[model samples]
Target: MTNTLEALTVPLIQAPMAGGPSNAALAVAVSQAGGLGMLAAGYKTVEAMAAEIDDVRAGTLNFGVNLFVPESDPSDPGRLAAYAAALASMALELGLAAPEPGPFSDDHYAAKVDYLVANPVPLVSFTFGLPSADDVARLRSVGTEIVLNATDPEEISAADALNPDAIVVQGAEAGGHRATHGQAKEPSESSTHELVTLAREYTDKPVIAAGGVTGADIAQNHFDAGASAVQVGTLFLTAEEAGTKEAQKDALLSGQYRDTVVTRAFSGRAARALSNRFTERMAAVQVVGYPQVHYMTAPLRAASADNPEGLNLWAGTGFAACQLRPAAEIVDEFRSL
Candidate 1:
């Protein structure tokens, strides 16, 4: 068997966009096209993740799975209630009940880890926080390659200590949630090329560049800066194999959304999304809750699926360059560039 990084025929990896966009079909297509495809394990149940893992396994073994490492940031009930009140009117306008904040959950982190340990896979990556050294040992013991996401030089040092197979250096230009270790601190604004260089100063571990990677030139820049590969999410959002909702796909190419902002209004944790009504209105009253605020606003997001302004339009700065073609074409295009 080849080392995970060396096995990639193309040095591009499909970013694991959690929620609905990432699916087994997208991963399979990317893998078949010479790049590594990743299934987003965040916001998914163990069984659902297992099914997707099975689906990917049936097609290719070059794919990977990315999990959100659970954090223990407790949400103040009063703050949660206050933010819930802030969203009340919008919920009512959509014929929904006032948003109810749920207790903080680890998103079934332990269960998901156990599942992966029992049924080993090709690769496993983590974000949000570092997994325990024991967990890393167990996974590595099975020959599963481990990768961790880092947003700054400090995070790179921390992840390096755990001895991951590689580190994904996410720049400020990335979309969706900024994978800061905790929900309390703000993310850094370093560019992908800058981060790759900075992280190399801390550790010799291979760095996989992410964020605002729109085309071949940017990918080459990272590789020139000593990056092993470039992980892209925004470019694949519009791929035909992607599960991106129609509303989001239209918003990406509609010319209506030109800018993206990093705000915590939607999930109570800072994330990058197209500036829209929900983010704009809730910006002031935003609270620091993870799954709590995530669940609190679920009904509103679901009810307003047809209304792009009310949904979490997660896209990176390079979203405008996304092409509406098969994922294989997108991966091949990146490889040939």
Candidate 2:
């Protein structure tokens, strides 16, 4: 409750990577290593996420949970329908039927928030968008410290209005989905260094820099650039304890993926992912909706799990620095700086 930066011993945070990357084992390992480990609750049922939280508590007490603030508006059904048809082709190839588009759910925002409020954790961070002021107040009433993710100066200013305990300045170089509040808003092209610097100029709150940070050198660079700490997601993706799929793990290590690209093909919302066949095919065909596109591609993604070329292997610009080792060792590498 009202956790401080000191709750994170090494000032290194294991970024909350959703969609099967971040897991209890990875989080507990990072926390055990004297760093803050975060559980990604995006795309998970409230019950499943709570079970994972219980597991994390059993492993380590110092940890945080990150949630995706549900999209404010559902995507156009027609657009979602069209995207579904495109994904259906891949679904059929995988021997799976294409799922029909449905009304978008908030990924159980109310339930998850209520759960956390009733059973508070040491820390809670929000991404994709900021939580409602009432919800933020409710969590704070229970003494939970709130941290909001922001990608640019405007978003940082917006977060300041909520008076969060801390802010994560996510740069464009960040892996996974860009956390811009508006679905249609363009993400800033600034590097983590520049974003952190700009965010520092706007708010006095503790700023945690996220994106493309693979090692102590990169972490130190962010610290020097005015970040109080650095959040690294891709680095741990290759860690032995990470929940990253074997295919995704292979893709990161595969020299075949020479560069990472920001694409909306996989999840609709623009996110940084390893270049793959799916990304190439759906580049122009994708829609601007979030979980709708996210749900539409679910079947294709599941079917393509075996084929690394077809899956959305999310990674940052520093993916090449990823290593296959214990997560604690990965944390140590960043903490040593």
Candidate 3:
């Protein structure tokens, strides 16, 4: 594992937004602008991730791949059923039958690791949980720099024990799923700056500040707080190269959403999304069954493809400052800070 922060012309890393916002073209553009671009390997097959890696490689080698470590304990079956029942009405609204929960899969974690070992990239990061010691060794043996995400001081201590090259300090304000180590534990509410300072007290590993970073000044504040680099995801959702759906982009740009809240209603894992009809309606009834609840709501989300109010509009608190532009321009703007 290596620290590529010093080699970067812009000490910024684009957060690997797992759903549709992330794409090869967007990653390449950020890398071309002298920042680290990343491919989100979550919710994708091993082959699909490899194809995207190839696409990014075609433009630049300064890139990384992010993956979700498989959940150790399966989500409670009772919770899955309960959540499915709760989503039945939404399914009916979409002219579909009652939602059925599916069996949990490991997200092909082992195979994706194997692929990365065989085709090593400059960096590889893990969210949800840290990989096994042997897995980390194997990836490092191939010259792949490893980064692990941490939400609070306790998680930072856990990540330090793994001895990764760096740690992504994801604050509570981060968009998308909170990278808590286990599904059962409640995530901490430390801000990005506080997390960065807290992490420094535990380890000397590079700290990459993530969450609510909107512009140059905020990113600079993170650096001043001892972060090696700043990672931004929401800011790039509107980039020309992004694969963000039109509904999501329009909702974000419309100024209709005055605030964002962390909700498990959409995916059963705590994620920050703009307040909408789905979040409001299902807030009280949702359960903690990640991929299961995520799948159960899939048909409804697809059926409401054109309606932003029915879908997950993941965004950080700083989303209001987001601008529609090219990925390169976004990275360049952060660099100039």
Candidate closest to the true structure, highest lDDT: 1
Q: Which digits, one per residue and each the tens of the lDDT, describe model 2 over residues 124-215?
A: 99988999999999998887888999988999999988999889998888888999996777789988889888987789888998998877
Q: Model 3 off-target regions past 4 Å?
A: 1-3
Q: Where is model 2 more than 4 Å wrong at Cα?
A: 1-3
Task: Give the per-residue lDDT digits (tens) of candidate 3, residues 1-337.
Answer: 1556667789899999988888999999998899989999998999999999999999998899999998765688888888888888888888999988866778999999999999999899999888999999999999988999999888899999999999999998898899998776777888998998888898899899999998889888888888888999999999999999889999889999998988888777889999999999998887777777787788899999999989999999988877788998888887775
Against the true structure, what is each candidate's TM-score? 0.98, 0.96, 0.98
- Candidate 1: residue 308 Cα off by (Å): 0.3
* Model 1 poorest ten-residue lDDT run: 1-10
Candidate 2 backbone overlaps, count: 0
* Tens digits of lDDT, candidate 1, 226-254: 98899999989999999999999989989
C-alpha local distance difference test of each model: 0.89, 0.86, 0.89
In candidate 3, which residue pairs get closer than 3 Å at backbone N, Cα or C atoms, i.e. clash? Answer: none
Where does model 1 exceed 4 Å of error?
Answer: none
